[model samples]
Target: MKLRRDGESVYVRPMKLDDAEALYEMRTRNQDFFQTYEPIRQKLVMTLEDYRDRISDDIQHWRDQTGFTFGVFLQETNEFVGRVSLSNIVYGAWKNCTIGYFMDQAHNGKGYTTEAVSLAVDFALTDGQLHRVQAAVMPWNQASVRVVEKVGFRFEGLSKWYLQINGNWEDHNIYAITQEDWNK
Candidate 1:
């Protein structure tokens, strides 16, 4: 789905093989800025072939009902801004998943992250048929914390050493919005 904010248009669409180059460019440009908060990349250099394979895997994941990764893009220029994903999906008794996202540093503080996340949450709860969507952010990454908060995710406390970020075990603040929460 596409969302509009301010005067710019943004879209949340499934990742495609054709998007490899733009995705690579965005990631390479923001590598340094993202290292602190994101997981370390195993490879120092990524080829278009690698991205194609990755996108292919993403497609399989989507078909298998394991996860969905959406690319956020600028509708006017078709620039890849970032990605938001709903991973670790569980069904039956536990209908839930985790949401993760990152944006180009150049696009920070522009509400695009929040809009992308909001769209993901809606997809998860409605089309995806999930009960809860959760996100975890490093305490120091105030921008990400704000994005989740803006999307109505309530703070659910911290998880000590919850995730390995940039080779270090980092504490994370957990936030979530349930189907019931959305209904209200």
Candidate 2:
């Protein structure tokens, strides 16, 4: 299932194996910059094959309804710009999902992430039919905070030591948008 949605400057779609090369390049180029915000997963540079394998798992996650990750690409140039995901989807009584994303450092402040977040939230609330979508950002990540805010996610509260990033527990400002909020 290759699902895609187009924005003026970019498109969001389920990443395919053939996209591995560009994805690998983007991740590698932004490796240092991304590490500051992301969790410490590994020390070695990930191989192209690793990205392919990861995409395979991500595709499975989509099919299983547990998560969905989309590659954000520059529409005009057809270049990889970033990745966004609605992960940890919960059904039944608690219909919700967690949204996460990262962009190549070179693409920062270009409205790509804001557009991607909007697309992801729209998909979760409208297409996926989830009740709520949430994003947690380190208090210092003002850029990310702005992204979610621009997408209409209201600040819910703060959680102390919510998640460990770079080996240390960090506080996160939680933000969310519910189905009702989306209807507005």
Candidate 3:
């Protein structure tokens, strides 16, 4: 869909096969930082070939209207900083999807993640024709909760053991914004 967003110092666009190496490095470098909030990676270090294959699969998913993943990069240097995704799409009567994102530990609290997510929500509601976009965050993950709240996702209470994160079933605080909410 060629979705892109340029912030004051960074930009967000779809992930490409050529981004395999940078993505790999970003994941590896942030392993410790992300481990607390993310599901446990099957591998400690993902090989470049494996990442390339994964990116290929992601491209196919994007083409098939199943999901979208975007890479966040520095505007001038093009340094890979993070990623955001809109997944679990369902059409028909639902027309909904879930959003998730992570940024480089060094880049936290800089507002880049908020900008990227805002752009994604706009694209999903307008261009992708989605009626709703949702996100869930671990109760302890204040940073993520702030991101969603900053983007105007309303609190929708908690889901017990909502997702398996860091190898354990964890409760999540669910939040969402509908197209109606966005239009207002």
By summed lDDT, the worst window of 10 consecutive residues in model 3 runs over: 1-10
Sequence-dependent TM-score of model 3: 0.95
- Top candidate when judged by TM-score against the true structure: 2
Report clash pairs, candidate 3: none
1-184 in candidate 1: lDDT tens per residue?
2322222467788899998988888888988998888777788788878888988988998899899899998777878899989999999998989999999999988888988888888888888889999899999988888899988999999999999999999999999999988888
23-44: candidate 2 lDDT, tens digit per residue: 8988988888988897898646
Q: Would you estimate the TM-scores of all the predictions?
A: 0.93, 0.96, 0.95
Sorting all predicted structures by TM-score, with the top scorer first, yields 2, 3, 1
lDDT of 2: 0.91
lDDT of each: 0.86, 0.91, 0.89
TM-score, cand. 1 vs. native:
0.93
What is the alpha-carbon lDDT for the whole of candidate 3?
A: 0.89
Kindly list the per-residue Cα lDDT of model 3 for residues 57-163, writing each as its tens digit. 87998899899888888887999988889999999999999999989898999998998898888889988889999999998988888899999999999999999
* Distance from true location, Cα of 154 in model 2, Å: 0.4
Kindly indicate the candidate among 1 and 3 with the higher TM-score. 3
- Candidate 2 lDDT at 6 equals 84
Predicted model with the maximum lDDT: 2
